[model samples]
Target: MKILDKYILKTFVITFTSVFVILFFIFILQTVWLFISELAGKDLDFILVIKFLMFAMPRIIPLVLPLSVLLASIMSFGDFAENYEFAAMKSAGISLQRTMKFLTFFILILSLGAFIFANNVIPYAEFKFINFRKDIAQMKPAMAIAEGQFSDVGSYNIKVDKKSGENGNFLTGITIHKKSNNFDGSKNVIKAKNGELISNEKSNILKLVLNDGYYYEDIIPKKYEERNKIPFAKSSFKKYIIYIDLSKLNNTNNEDYTISNTNSMLNISELKYTIDSLENNRKKDIISFVDNSYQRTVTQGSLSSNKALNDSIITTKIKNPDLLSNFIPKEQSEILQIANNSIINTNYTIDSTEQELESKTKVINSHWIALYDKFVIAFACILMFFIGAPLGAIIRKGGLGLPIVFAVLIFIIYHFVNTFGKKIAQEDGLTPFLGCWMATFILTPIACLLTYRATNDIGFINMDVVLLPFQKLFKKIFPSQNQ
Candidate 1:
């Protein structure tokens, strides 16, 4: 590498690394706050909390990388600008555009990293993170069963009288109250002499092994005339295995799972199958609707023809009573009425089928829209870098305080607009991709403008100068303003 390239690379790496670390910690702190809020008033495993952070790192990297690049660029360039290194480079016949060539290359590399992170690493991390949360939730019973407190675990309320950690297991005096609303509102209480929680890791089963327990069930009598004293069953056991259902811990491949917009995370074959299935479903719906409409039309014509025949026969009977018996028989008239009724019933069935077909078409359209939105979100990461980098250069503030605030505010605004657009697209018949990426689309031009202004040294709005007059006027108007 040239000396200049090395200098730029070194500065970029240092700034990027420092900013990434700071942003990562911020991300962790925010995640911890969110997790704590979510798990508030519930017992959570501390180890799981750490596990969540570890799983979350990959997902956080995607978010951090773009902003890190933006911040690092601004800081590195700002440092150059502040120290007159940019002037020195210019004095050495190096143009600003040429200087930016190195940074642009750096940005390209970072963008590729972001893409890889988003496409591969982030998806895997998200999948694991989601499963980790599910595992934590499944382990709620073991976590909730604290010493000397009643904890509701699935269908049973269990209270441990004493608990002690012994040889990689928990030994406790367990009392269980199992209530079943299914059995005409009955309550069963089981008191055990002693029990130990034995977790079989291979099977993912939490076994509550009880020794010497009696089950007492209180059942409500169906009738007042009948005796209502429910007999409690007492049974002494050497050991009992109350298996905790950990079916939730079993990992299942979610073929339909889509992250961002890339279908590569999903089984591509499954996505293709899904698309094909939806297409077939749509075709079927259209065919069904057409068939039903045709059937209804045929039934309507038949019903009209029958009514006309019945009207003509009645008119003939009125015109000549002697010829009435020859014109139409009583049995034949009854048959015509029944045929008309049958046609009307057939028409009603066709109408119902048409309504169902319409509904299915709407559902198919919704899924297509959802698929489109996913694609937009996946590609928006690249757009985000373009937006962030130029904005950073325009702001010319590289410190943690200003850059962070700027990044967060931009993200928040972008997120809100994007979310709102998606909702509109989903619910209000807006274009799906357009709705999902409207924020990015709208901000691109703004970013371009910022880039242009920054490059040309065009002065944009300065909040510091804008607020300075107000600050001075406030001090003059109110002495307490200074205080």
Candidate 2:
């Protein structure tokens, strides 16, 4: 029995390792295709491209590991089934469930290791991947002006509506935004009908010549000038020259990347902390908004000749257009003044609500999704192992041919369901727990069904059972006519 267990384990281990390498390389090709445009023709260093791929590799592991387990298990067990190895084992008094014990233990360990990698390695890789992508985008400042997309270049962000000329240099309908300084928080915008970029790599400067453009720069208001509108200067230039410094573009040589507390960059524990903080702050904002709205609508009563007052009355109640019949001339002016203030306050409330809701979704739901996602993929590894092993026995078709087809089909379904759940979760349509685990709930039952069928040695569909009743009904309906 010990010798047999070792023999079974040897094939499983070898198949698993080979499948992992094949699947990892296959998924890397997908990553390359996705960002090929970002890397191609940008004159980037080979080392930068390699670093980008290296950082991106970890993100794909979580996606591939489960699929590899499925494929390898299916292929290995399919071979065992085809060779009637299970029959020989059963003849020797070994049950199918007993045969799975060692493999099951191995799979559990792999699942835990996957969890560790997801928690520790992926977060670091994701952070580096994002920053490396940014650095690559900066390699050619001109290419950064991608049509219909905002591209950040140094301290300025540029977008061009139409791009023409060789290497996409000539631009039309251009908008440029310089980063706002922290001190005053004013925006500087440049809108141009067209522009052309000329790079001076030797001096680390980019010259953008704009034709028929207007420059708009916001002037920060003094503390006392808060009530006044923020003053801005706008002027038109037939031809303007804007100098952009590129000295800081990838200046670190890919060393020190600033790790943001953004959802994608943070691990599970960091994610939980950020989620709690955002929820607490969001609650405070809701309370503050409600208080401000109440203060605006209800105020202390002032003595009136035609007293129709409570300690506090909503401004709307007193001066509502529908309540014109109750109007008193002396209170009319005051009511009108209060009515205008109430209108402004209502709009303010609406804007505040929208802004806070967006912030909460961005800061809270995103982190929650990331947190749940870590566990989902880790658990999927174990789940896929069960699914694949049994499916292999039932199919009884070994080698890459049939196993590849089944593995890819199942993975596509899994990946699609997982992506759908995450999308709805991000939209707040479902709770984080439900949305993140949605696929697991749906797939677990299928896995169980397959396992039961394989253990009982039932055929994939039990076609004869399904067709017998239909055949009998057909015979009854037509009586076969002795044909």
Predicted candidate 2 versus true structure: per-residue lDDT over 1-483, tens digit per residue: 488878878889999999999889988999999998787745466787788899999999878899988999999999998999988888898877777788888888998888888888998888878877766766665556677767777778888888777667788999999897676577889999998988754666878899998999887666755626878999999999888876666443546665454677788778888888889898898888889767755552233333553223335354555664455654566666666766786888789798867768765777888898889888998889888989998898899999889999998988888889888878888887788898888889888988899888786799999899998888889996738
The alpha-carbon deviation from the true structure for residue 215 of candidate 2, after best TM-score superposition, in angstroms, is 15
Tens digits of per-residue lDDT, candidate 1, 1-483, equal 588978877877898888789889998888878776445434555766676788877766645665566566666666676577766886898765666676677666666655555545655676667666555544533554655767656567888776665332454577898857684666777788777776654565667888877777764666755536664456666777787665554332333432343232333244456667866987887788789768866655435445656565455544555543544576356655766787787788778877776565555445544455444444554555555555555555556667677767776777688778866765546765577668778877876777676566554566778899998888899987678
Q: For each candidate in the order shown, give its overall lDDT on alpha carbons.
A: 0.63, 0.81
Q: After superposition, how far is residue 422 of candidate 1 from its true place, in Å?
A: 3.5
Of candidate 2, the 10-residue stretch with the lowest lDDT total is 303-312
> lDDT for model 1, on a 0 to 1 scale?
0.63
User: Cα RMSD for candidate 1?
Assistant: 9.0
Off by over 4 Å in 1: 36-52, 88-93, 136-162, 167-194, 198-206, 210-241, 245-279, 282-395, 426-429, 461-483
The most accurate candidate by TM-score is 2
